[model samples]
Target: MSIDQDLSHVQSLLDPSEVIPPTSPLYGPNAQGWAVQKDLHPRLVAVPTSPESLARLIAHLYKSHLHFGIRGQGFLSASAKDVLVSMTAFDEFHFDPHAEVATVGAGQTWGAVYRKLKEAAPSYAIVGARTPAISVGGTVVTGGLSWLSAEYGCISDPENMLDAQVVKSDGSVVWASTEPDLLWTMRGGGGGFGVATKFLFRVRPYPQAIWAGPILLPRQQLPTVATRLEAFLASNPDPRVSMFLYIIRKNLLETIGAFQDMLVVHAYDANGEEHGREAFKWALDIPGAVDQTGVTDMEGVTKLQQNVDKSKGTMRQYWAPLFLKTLSAATITRAIELVDELAKQDSAVSDCTYLIFELFALCDAKGSCAWPRPPGAKHVILIGAGCPANASAGQEEMARNLAEDASERILGSRTVNLLANGGEEFHDPVMIWGENLDRLRQLKKVYDPNGRFQGPIRA
Candidate 1:
């Protein structure tokens, strides 16, 4: 029960490989993550290979009061603390075609899950990260967005989530999903509820050749193309197609040009290539444009997200989002010009993407998640930027400022997500969570009375 006992009990229950000491050379390897959340020391780190190991580790940390952090695929990183547990060893994938769902491990990445799911059922898929490195746990907890989002809604299953095996904050193992409030919070509440070892997500069937890929448009035709994109999704347009507009410095948009040049990074996902091309012919009509459109399997969906790979090893990044009601022509033009302006100012800012998440499925469902948005709001926009590690403080600050200004314009004292606080630009959690903050705080009291989970919320 004491901290100085060396946690011999935790080591005894699992294989020797599961326990990683802080003094060992592998310490840093186990402590590292995709995003460097903060600076903290991890006195003890363990990679649990099974749910039982995780549960036992939790019990030890609880008795010692050494709040732990769950590092899954290093997607959501933070400074290691008293204890750090890597779910990487929990990577398990099992898909039941008859049940039409996938029992995926939290440690598994979208890429790995996709590969296995395709082998088991290529005709079926689930909402997941667009990159292989993003863990299924992070994506599902944070309202995962995917190419098939228009049809399937958020990648996490709140309504259809079968069950989740988790180690509650009190160091007891429990299966969630049947608990309405707790399940809703875990569905999209961004962790902090409990340490989930595995999740059951309802798989969706494609039943056809999926046509999807990026289609670059002429930089000069930003206005023209933006208008068409807005109109394409204005009505009850087919939910089969999803769009993501990235307006970045023309230099990054293409392989060549001045650092300040800008372009519209447009992409499409559809049941078929012709359907995708036909859906946005107005954009194709533009002259002197580059087309890199191609069809790939379901696994290829997350693979196309090249930014994650490019940002590896020391790249500094920031993400700020806003859920907008509509994408009018004027709104689109202003957004593009804003990106150009921001890129011109901060050369370190590689690109700023306008991420649009289909919210049609969110219409009939309100108050279903802790992350709140206005009614009739069917799209979520995020202006994210990545810079070299050596980028000046001013450069990162400028990027944060640009995104915050745009978000406040529509969100109005309400922020979709908090801005980067380490480098000075900080947005209050109240802005991001608003009224939900109180609810989560109360929920934390019920689930994690001691706030031992420490995933996102402080309460």
Candidate 2:
């Protein structure tokens, strides 16, 4: 644990400028993750500019048996106490029109990628993360659930993720598909096998403008909204339509001097305005509702999504994904009750918390994913609880408990997502990869035998 000795060794191998010690002002921010609770301190941070440099650093760390974590856009918590490798320098994006594919660097954010696509490839779309700020590489390898997932499946599915370039523990760079096992494990099996430098994504046709926007209604209308949502799910809506229902208190609703709860519905229709409006006509017609629904292109849709997801920045946040067999009336009612309980238990926590219900139509594109998609389930409920950055440990624990309790009540079995960091230790690979757990572990041993890489699933 000689910090100076390790820093000197690392600096000798790579450029001195690439190595950042804790003494540096940049180290403070670089060490912290998106969530304040994951404010871990790494002994040193490495910022490699090229894949060859990354390979060299990873190889050295592996040979020395030093554990390091890869940081991409700081979306997930890093397991770095020794060395942290920041992928920001790898920001590269190239789209090929003839091949209809995109070569996206691991460091690129969905927001940057979306903007580029809008300018050069507006007629094409890649299955990408809904939130604009989330990193591309982290989302894909960890099982990306995108707005277009209903149509094209996960972004990491074999169909969408055509190929990937990874740097193995031995410092040898190779296409993941060359090692069939590595490719399968990387496809939604979760990270830790190796450092995925970049990926080739097959783009789909984005021919028409989509109808999307948010509508805010009084929380008292939960029952009525729930009934309609239940029917909407049961009615087998078009695959082109995806909707998110959120129960949020007004304190976080960007409204001043208002603490009342509000039900926010964000509806999207990929089929255009006419059909999109008709499908969600019931919700639009609700009285005393503040509706902002309209037709917009992909850029507008992405901007709307970014605006709605105000969960980023320096804050203590916890979110858990609860998959339901059916969005029945009873289930909806119980969910509402859980949200209410959370609010009543702690007023301070309630003001900063919100619950989300993702209602998607029947999609057949999840068959090729490594992460097991819950069978017979179309709705995934996520409860997000947060506290202030400077909150005490007890306050953070209270917020986490509120979110986890609600998630457990609705969950029939455990589901894992790197983003669903609700104070749960995901050391069990079975919970994440499910049936592919054994195979993924075998590949981990083969590729990362010394366990130099750190991720949710431990080898």
Candidate 3:
């Protein structure tokens, strides 16, 4: 069928408020979230308010040859000519105290879920992203990292994901959690495995309040501080404490606007601040370093999570993960040298940061979810580079090349949340899934025979 024919079908199925035509003023800004390139635009944007309505649209889309992109919070960095489906309106929140589980709609964000949960149930918490704006469905489906990851595992661990309400390619509503095969795919397999309208996450006991925050230090101290941090990880003192190392080249905020390498320690202790202080002892003890630690609630932590919020859609960006086998002084030294090299070019590695994601041992590959930590990897080294939105084409390429070059130095697997930022760059499934690629492919074939769902895997 023609594009107009498809538009007309969607128009007849959903209300005029739900379907945003190409000419609608609301369409342009809504589409702007995912369309990083100015030249790219969607043919149409659809927001179905209910499952029955969304199912109808999916049924129609499946029968037609139209390619569509699924969106939650419009966080995608890629823009295609296909129709974009926004699941923002399918909002539903229900917590089962007896089963210790929460069923959240795909349209909800971690912040929203946290707020709702806070008002209703304060004792339990769902594993999710640090930022409140990030969607629940997108993060959990991609093996989301969290402060509690050491105690538990990735947010999308198969054991924690009890069930999912999925909309099949054929337009039928099926409870995917009933089958082990479908449940495994939903856990860290990425959102291309059909439309998951509602996700059931296993809730864990959360502290009513905890002590956490960042402690800044001079960039010159990275060598000594990193060695101590390596020693801290080697101790394996407590699973509740997490550490993130930020080598900020663009932190022109304080201390005469000088660039510095900062260590932000996160302690999930409900009782004492001693463990968090010990975890980052070397850096916190540094003279002239800024102290930003305190005892606070999750809301305080969410507010502190405003780290890289400045350049969301306003810049041309590239981000990817690097898995480090160990956080040795050698690795830290190599990273500092590379960042210094990139800084010489233009200093675009401003907000590029890495976290000491301890406890990959907690992530067991015995479940159905295909997401696994790289063979011997321990820390998640996330690298990012960004330039102004109006940056010259050559300049943008240079920035991406710099980040890619830094990532090439360390051999690691991919993180799920960042699967969309590969603009015009093809990321091999093998690098992410390894031997599990074949199994994911076979499952994709069974669930979606046609190449309809364009997720991370392309079998």
Residue runs of model 3 more than 4 Å from their true location after superposition: 22-25, 249-251, 255-271, 307-309, 348-362, 374-376, 410-425
When sorted by TM-score, best at the front, the candidate numbers are: 2, 3, 1
* Top candidate (lDDT): 2
**For model 3, the run of ten residues with the poorest summed lDDT:** 415-424
List candidate 2 segments past 4 Å from native: 23-25, 252-259, 307-313, 365-367, 411-423, 426-429
Per-residue lDDT of 176-219 in model 3, one digit per residue for the tens?
86667887887777657788898888887777567777676776
The lDDT for every candidate, in the order shown, is 0.64, 0.74, 0.66
Query: Candidate 1, which ten residues in sequence have the lowest lDDT sum?
Result: 416-425
Which pairs clash inside model 3?
none
Residue 130, candidate 1: C-alpha displacement in angstroms: 2.9
1 or 2: which has the higher lDDT?
2
Model 2 worst lDDT window (10 residues): 417-426
Residue 268: error of model 3 in Å?
A: 5.4
Per-prediction TM-score to the true structure, in the order listed: 0.86, 0.91, 0.89
